[model samples]
Target: MSVLPDPGASRAVLVGTSQYEHLEQLPAVSNNVQALADLLRGPLSLQLPDRHVTAVENPVAAHAVLGELRRAATEASDTLIVYFAGHGLVDAQDQLVLALPHTEFGRIETGLPYDWVRQVLLLDSRAERHVVILDCCYSGLALGRMSAGTGLADQAAVEGSFLLAAAAETRTALAPVGETYTAFTGALLEALRQGIPSGPALVDLGTLYRHLRLTMEARGHPVPQARDRNSAARVALGRNHANLPAWPVAAAAVADAPAGPDERPWPDPRAIRTVTGFLTALADVRVVSGLTQKAVSGRSAGSMTAGTVGRLLNRPDLPATWGTTAVYLSACGVPDEQITHWQAAWQRLRTQSAPAEAARPAATRDGGSGKPRVWQRPMSTFRRRRDH
Candidate 1:
């Protein structure tokens, strides 16, 4: 668990443009902004006040978005975050611009310039740390035009800033229609909601970026790119305030059990409705058994690695095979009867999840629906590029 400096204040500017005049309308953009805002305000998360968050939706001009960014940068004394979810374009001169509602195709002046946003963030002396999250095509270009003379290492030495972009310079970011969020934002929200594995009271930018990258790649989406300039990687983005007790009474009881075979008071397996709930219960069982992930891995005789155990406990989905589950249970010293209960729970969850998984859209070139609506223009050129 990383300890963060006591940032005096935190502020955020959330911008999302779903309704565009000359470009394709991304319906998921609105949901992306809302979800990020909710997570920032969550009790066990950032805990920012309503006044600290400024949300701009479907702005007609570049100034509308830039004005909010300027305000946040000037007002925030410690931490500032700017998030944009919309269309992005690279001009003939290779400048990246964020598209607004009234932005026209190839009209670089009409869109918000990424350089101007970066300048505002860099010039803000009030904020000690700055974080920029972009979920749009060509967003990686935000850092492309940054001071050319300064290398990434040099930039990191001076400014505490970070950039989280959805794709590389030539790649397109995707926002699947009908989904609550874009692939990148969905992974981000999940990371914040779940917190880091093991015992971490803080969620750092580095951990979040790694999670986003892995999640997007696993789902066959574009690999997200992260640039850490300064100490932003170590700076805490959110607090993990989950109400997990340090020591459970059940754990003490299990520890004091007779030497031959221990009896543990586990929760009713039938009550677990989701894969996360099942993994959490399993984690609790491990805590009661007083075994670390390494210890459990050792108990499995290297059948399962600590990394595998961590993923099994943290991932939203269950492990791929029943054998993995059995090995994990055996490592945790789970009795045969309890293992049977867990197996039943896993079967029920699998039965319920099959239809839901089948209903999801497959990973396509556009990463969205097959057909475009009458008002929407097809992003034929901006196809999704999945990582191998």
Candidate 2:
């Protein structure tokens, strides 16, 4: 694990606007800001004191927001995070602006210019690391004016900065009715709280972004976007409460057991009652082996990519080819002797789903459509017959 910055040296500015002078009010904005603030101050390793956190609610003037940002820029020496939950608009020039309580639709000058916020937080801030999270429509436009020279390799040239937007430049950010936070912010909070599975003890920007993007997209919500220029991918955002070691030492001991079939007690494939049950067992084995989907893919010599492994694990129905299942089990360090048991289980499942002709009733075999009596044999019986 990489060393984390001093939590005490970090500062945060949370701005939320639920009441607008002209636009419709968003009741969830306040809840969004409060939930984020609580996370940062509570579980997040950023032991940011209440004094270091500047929270602005329904600021009528753009200067007030800028003033809080300027203070954070001057005060923070290690890390700074600025979060906004409200409305976002694009001016005629395609520049993004934050909508304050008094911001009008046509008057861009009245809104807080995202460029100014970026400049102050990324360029002018004394902090070593900077993070900007926007939960509003057109938030992706926040990166529209970033310096073209700001490439991932130019980490030294540009301070480590990460920008996360709730939606695309053209899409509207959604707030599910009656929910406390918008879809994006809610997902963000959930990811942060749950942490990445089989990842490091500390969650970073890259991991958080990936989780956010996948989760929101899966829920049919607007896709979020991230712009990272300061090698911010590795910077720790918070401690992962859900972090688990890749592999337990005891598991390696189990793997060292003799591979001989005579000495090994293979589990009965018939014990698996349902596809979901089999998948749950497979997932448990993977976790115990301490290998991530990416690591499992690499161990498989690239035959199975990380995405493929994820899909296989997520879906209750096994892959079409038993070869894929075998590859995954082997990669997860399942004993070769035990793998055959899994393969047998997989074959049984496939046979159960095979064409009706394979095991059609006597009446059906004779082409008599007499509502062919359904064969309701237990899996154990089938296993017994196959053994014979």
Lowest lDDT sum, 10 consecutive residues, model 2, at 143-152
lDDT per residue as tens, model 2, 167-206: 5424333766677787788888887777777666567788
Tell me the TM-score of each prediction against the true structure.
0.57, 0.57
Task: Please state every model's RMSD to the true fold in angstroms.
Answer: 19.9, 20.5
Weakest 10 consecutive residues of candidate 1 by summed lDDT? 143-152
Please give the clash total of every predicted structure, in order: 1, 1
lDDT (0 to 1) per candidate: 0.67, 0.68
For candidate 1, write residues 1-388 as lDDT tens digits: 2323222256889999888777777777898898888877654455566777888999878788888888888887767888988877766766667778887767788898777877787775477778888777653233111111112222222256777777543333356556777767877887777665653445678877887777777886777767887667766666443423344234234345577754443434554555645665565556545667776777787798989888877765666568888888877778888788889988988888778767764442233455433234335522322221
Stretches > 4 Å off in candidate 2? 1-3, 139-159, 169-173, 244-388
After superposing all C-alphas onto the true structure, candidate 1 shows an RMSD in angstroms of: 19.9
List runs of model 1 lying over 4 Å from the truth: 1-8, 139-158, 169-173, 240-388
